[model samples]
Target: MDKIEFLTEKAAQIRRDLLKMIVNAGTGHTAGSLSNTDIMTVLFYEVMDIKVDDPDWDDRDRFILSKGHSVESYYTILADKGYFDKEELNTFCQYKSRLIGHPNNKVPGVEMNTGALGHGLAIAAGMAKAAKMSKKNYKVYTLMGDGELAEGSVWEAALAASHFKLDNLVGIIDRNNLQITDNTEKVMGLEPLAEKWKSFGWEIIEVDGHNYQELINAFTKSSEIKGRPTLILANTIKGKGVSFMENKAEWHHGLPSEEELAQALEELSSKGEVI
Candidate 1:
């Protein structure tokens, strides 16, 4: 099989793994996790330079999930990449389990305790700036939800990323229009979003979040940009894989019934195999 096909299959497996983890745990941010599956899959499997056995290795690429509630897929990808045992997924959300509703440093591959939203970009910019100060080549990547863009801190970090000229930092906004309470535009308008970032002195790249090719091309281009940070505005469906869940805001914190889980599994399966 070709590289795209392999990545596609791996993404499907990631979706299945996260779904089962959420369904079994009886709670999760399903829609956002599903939406960012393809993006996260590409980063972990293709783009990021990471070592599963040596997660803390110097010079490794760093990734922060600013929208940390969508962490089901994040944890699953970490375990699948062998940062931690896959069996730990079964204990997710249980009392005293490290895999709580949001991501924390307790997990092997997680960089910071996130979930409050809008803080990831600031932290990532700090890391990237430190890399420049220490003369290191590692790049820092952070993923944020579009709804989180309303946070004042996000723009402050954006300004800092540009002012410092941290070319090694890449920030991605998951442009899924729906948030927990309402549509993103309804809650807060972010149109001319790309222009806003460009005005802040960052290079802007727009892409279909689910298209592996577009995502790959965007990351490649980010590396070539100099004297500025890169911002990838990834347009995405809130619940991409499942028909019933697609674009529906109600699923933001919704739990699936066993029947719903079975249906979703079938939809995500390939050749009758989820994994």
Candidate 2:
């Protein structure tokens, strides 16, 4: 198989793991996880400088999952990256498990324990600044939820990153439009979101979050740009793939029923194409 085919299958595997794990765990942010599936896949598969051997390698780039509740996808990707046993995925939300519902640093590959709304950019800014001061080539990638960006800390962190000219930082917004309670437009309109980030000195890119090739291109384009942080506003459906869940706010934290789980599995296994 070609590299693209390989990556595509790997992405499907990640999503497959995500659905099964969420079904077994009985609780998780399924919609968010599904929405960011391709983004997480491309990052671990093709883009980042990371390895299972030493997740904390000083020269390696970093990934921070700011939307931490959507960790099933991220954890599956990490396991695929060889950070830990794929079997550990079964421990999610179970007693004495290293794989919690959120990304924890105790896990070999996670950079930070991040469930809070808007703090990742700040932490990423610090890492980027540190890399600059130390003259390192490492880059930092942070992913956030559009709903979460309503927090004031996001702006503060954005200001600080721009002030320091941390061009090595790449921030991605999973703009799924739906948060836990309501659509972002109803909760708080970040309509001018891209312009806002740009005003804060970030180079911005907008793309269909579910498209693997577009996501890869966006990530690649991010690496080539310099002198400013790159912020990608990835427009995505709240719950992707499964018909009943897509764009439904209730699925934000809903656990699929046994029947629904079976249904999702059947749908995903059908080799359906999504544009």
Candidate 3:
């Protein structure tokens, strides 16, 4: 019942919620959602200074899911945190449910609507700049997929974030390596990723994304940095908690069959309960 163990259990439950929501809805980005679950868990549950009861608090921290296809993880965490009713999760991806395939501003805790990829960092940069202008103490964080880095817009935003010295901005790359089409290297090479961010004037910190302690340490260190944005290269596994789906590109966007859902739930149950 310590911090690490608690976060671990919360991650497992979120993954379970994601799998069920996707399977029931008959659609979702399975691998990316699962891969980003731990990072989202730590952010919403521990790292970000958020108030579930008052999501629009003027000084509350802002988070953008730039790799918006991973909305399942974000939504699951929001619901669990009381940003909205958990039952609303069942309406995901339905004809008119607010919880669609990607993050939507209509959702209580969502900062902005995103799904286009490569745009989140830029938006986050603007938010960070606005915070600085208003002299707000809140931070702006955005999570992007490794594949999304291929877009020139991402680099453009990176340059802007550095030039402005937005130390309150944090960018996290979900370095799971597997995108929808293939491995990131095969689709679009982004090797020496840390060096690339460093060159962009970011304080780069690489860590095992699934490890709560490592994530907490990285986020904590990010806050102490000055005069530069921080980029966390979160090395993670695609379809992280599910054995058959792990590291598989096909699971990037797919629906799990009944048997698959059962197996995934059983695997999550073995990890321990969310206390």
lDDT of 3 at 43: 92
Best by TM-score: 3
Worst 10 residues of 2 by lDDT: 266-275
Report the number of clashing residue pairs per model: 0, 0, 0
Better of 1 and 3 by lDDT: 3
Better of 2 and 3 by lDDT: 3
| C-alpha lDDT (0 to 100) for residue 274 of candidate 2 | 27
Model 2, runs deviating above 4 Å: 272-275
- Which pairs, if any, clash in model 2? none
TM-score of each: 0.98, 0.96, 0.99
| True lDDT of residue 208, candidate 1 | 97
Per-residue lDDT of model 3, residues 1-275, tens digit only: 78988988989999998899998899898999999999998998899998888989999999999999999999988999898999999999999899989999999999999999899999999999999999999999999999999999999999999999999999999999988899999989999899999999999999999989999999999999999999999999999999999999999997899999999999998986865
Q: What is the lDDT of candidate 1?
A: 0.93
lDDT of 1 at 218: 98
lDDT (10s digit) by residue, model 2, range 1-275: 66576666776667778888888888788989989987887788788887679777889999999888899899988887788898988888999998988989999989899998788888999999999999999989999998888899999999999888888999999999999999899899988888989899989999998787888899999888888889988999887878899999999989898899888877776643321
